[model samples]
Each structure stands twice: as structure tokens, then as C-alpha cells.
Target: MTQAAIQVRDLCFQWPTGASVLQFCSLDVPKGEFWMLLGTNGSGKSTLLRLLAGLLQPQSGEIKISGQVGFVFQNPDHQLVMPTVGADVAFGLVEEKLSLAQIQARVHEALTAVNLQLLQRRPIYALSGGQKQRIAIAGAIARQCEILLLDEPTALLDPDTQLDLVAQVRNLVKSRGLTALWVTHRFDELNYCDGAFLLEQGRVVDRGAPEHLKQRLMQ
Candidate 1:
């Protein structure tokens, strides 16, 4: 069997007001593969993604993820902290003990990966929505994260940018040998994934071939 990069077994969670979000949810994404999570609103897809990213703690169950984790928010404005592209990309490395030269090298490599190296000196405010999203991705790459968790990274972009972003991520996964779990509602985005999971009422109702899941939803 293929080894899993992200593994969750019987995971459970609820809000402080007692609104249950997950009910013994379980999933496993094999190493070096790309998977998408599909669900209607309030299906606990975002909650599950946040839990996997460690942004929120589950009340019960287990989440095991190998290697470093990178999270891209649905809104890039919510995650980008620094003023400039280069500064923001390197921001995550602040907690690491790397030297200045090493940090710069990492930032360069990451920006290049996202095709944003030329905009390194650009201000965050001057960027379009698409560029800002790419910068957010570059931040994760700079951290050398082996796994990526994106919660609707294309929601705010135009149709063209959305498809482009998804294609870019697929290439990144294949070229870098990284694993990714993206939460999305757009069925068109399904074409780029290796597999997919359908979330309903906080549990995974269907999973496996992306095309199969797509057809199931359409019918």
C-alpha cells in the first residue's frame, strides 16, 4: 500500500456553543499525491482542513501528518503579514534558526517556484488578487513544507485565474513530490486532482477516483 502523508482516523470536533462539525471523520492522502475535498457549505470541510493544518484542535481522534505542513487560506489577505513579496515569503522562517543568507536563498527559490521571483520587491497592496494568492503559496514553499493544505484558494479569483492556480499547484505537487489536500466546491477543479473525497454532514461519504466523484455529484 502507498504510505500516507496525511492520516486522520475517527476525528471529531465541535464549537464552544456545541455545534458539532465533524463526526468520526477519517481520511488518508497518500504521499506525493494531490487530493481534493468536496462538500456543500456547513459540511465540515473547512473545519477538517483547519484541523489538519493545526489551526484548530479537534475535541477527539487523531491527525497524523508527515513532514512540515503549509496552509493557504481562502483569502490571501488573511494570511500575508509582511509588506513586500520577499518579506512575506520569508516571514514563516522567523521561527527557524537559519542565517540571513540561507533565508534569502529559500525565499528566492520559493518565489521562483510560484513564478513570482520578479515581484519580490513589489508591495503586497500593489498586487492583484491572483498574485497575492501566489505569494501566499510561495510562503509555504519557503518553509520547505512537504504537505500543503489549501482551503478554497481559488474562491476569490476570476475563472481564468482559478483554473491557472489549480494547474500550477498540480505541477508543483508533481515536480516537488509534495502532497496536497485542497478543499473546493468547484467541480471543474476536480479534473486536476489524483483523487477526491466528498464530505457530507461532517463525514466523508465518498472517495476515490476524481472522475467518479465528479460524475456522482453531477447526477
Candidate 2:
């Protein structure tokens, strides 16, 4: 079997208000696989994504990741902080103590990868919602993370822009061999995924190819 890029074993969690969320959830994601996570509101999809990103600690169980992980949250505002697009992409590299030359190179490469090279110097706040989300994606790519996690990445995007973003994501997975887990409520959005997991009431109730799962869901 391929070594799992991400592993969650017997995971459990709850909010401070004593609302139980995840319970005995276990999952294994292989390297370079594209996995879509589906669930209704308050069904622990976002919670599980946060746990995998190491942003939230599970109350019980073990989580292991084999490579650097990048997380793009539902809201672009939470990820983009620098005044300009260039600065935002270079932020994480600076933290890694990369030299100025190296940071600039990586930033340029990431921007070009997302087809946003021309927007590097633009003021972040002046960009449209789709542009801002692309900037966030560039920043994550600049980090050189092998695993990319996105939560409702295209929720607020127009149809055209959403398709563009999905294409970019697909390229990242194919070109960089990046492992991705996308969480969303829309089943139609998952046509690009290699496989999928269906969650109901905080547990994974089904897992299979997206087409197969869709057939089962319809039945």
C-alpha cells in the first residue's frame, strides 16, 4: 500500500460549549490523491479540515502528516494579510529565513504558476474576490507545501471564476504531485476529485469514486 500522506486515527473533538463534533473518525489519504470531503452544515467537515491542518487539536486520537501542509480557508481575508500581492506570497518564505533572492524567486514562480504574475504589485484590497483568492493560493504554493487543503474554496466565486480556480487547483495536483483535500457541500463541485468521502452527523458514512458516490447518493 502507498504510504499515507495524511493519517487520522480514532479522532474525536468537541467545542468548548460541550457540543460534540467529530467522533471516532479515522481516515488515510495517499500521496498525490485528490480527495473531496462532503457533508452538510455543522457536520464536522470544516472541523476535520482544521484538525488536518494542525490548526485544531483533536480531543482524542492521533493525526500524522508526512509533508508540509498548506491550508486555504473559506474566507480569503483570513489568509491574505500583506499590503500587496507580492508581499503576501513572500511572507512565509521570509519566516523560513530564506534569503531575499530566494524569496523573490519563489514568489515569482508561484505567481506565474497561478497565472497572476502581472498582479504581483497590485494592492490586495483593490482586487476582486476571485483575484484575492488566487493570491491566497499563490501564497500557499509559495510555501512549497506538498499537501494542500481547501475549505469551500469557491463558495463566493462566480461560475467562470470558480472554474478558473478549479483548473488552477487541478494543475497544482498534476504538475506538483500535490495531495489535496477539498471540503464543500456541493456535490457537483467534486467532479474533479479522484475519490470522495461522505460525512453524515460527523462520521464518514461512505467512500468511493466521485461518480460512484453520486450514484449512491442519488439512490
- Best lDDT among the predictions, by candidate number: 1
Q: What TM-score would each prediction reach against the true structure?
A: 0.98, 0.96
lDDT value for candidate 2?
Answer: 0.86
* lDDT per residue (tens digit) for residues 99-160 in model 2: 88999999999999888999889999898878888888788889988998999999988888
Off by over 4 Å in 1: none
lDDT tens digits, residue span 51-152, model 1:
998889999999999999999999999999999999999899999999999999999999999999899999999998889989988999999999999999
Clashes of each: 0, 0
Shift of residue 157 alpha carbon in model 1, Å: 0.3
Reference-based lDDT, each prediction: 0.94, 0.86
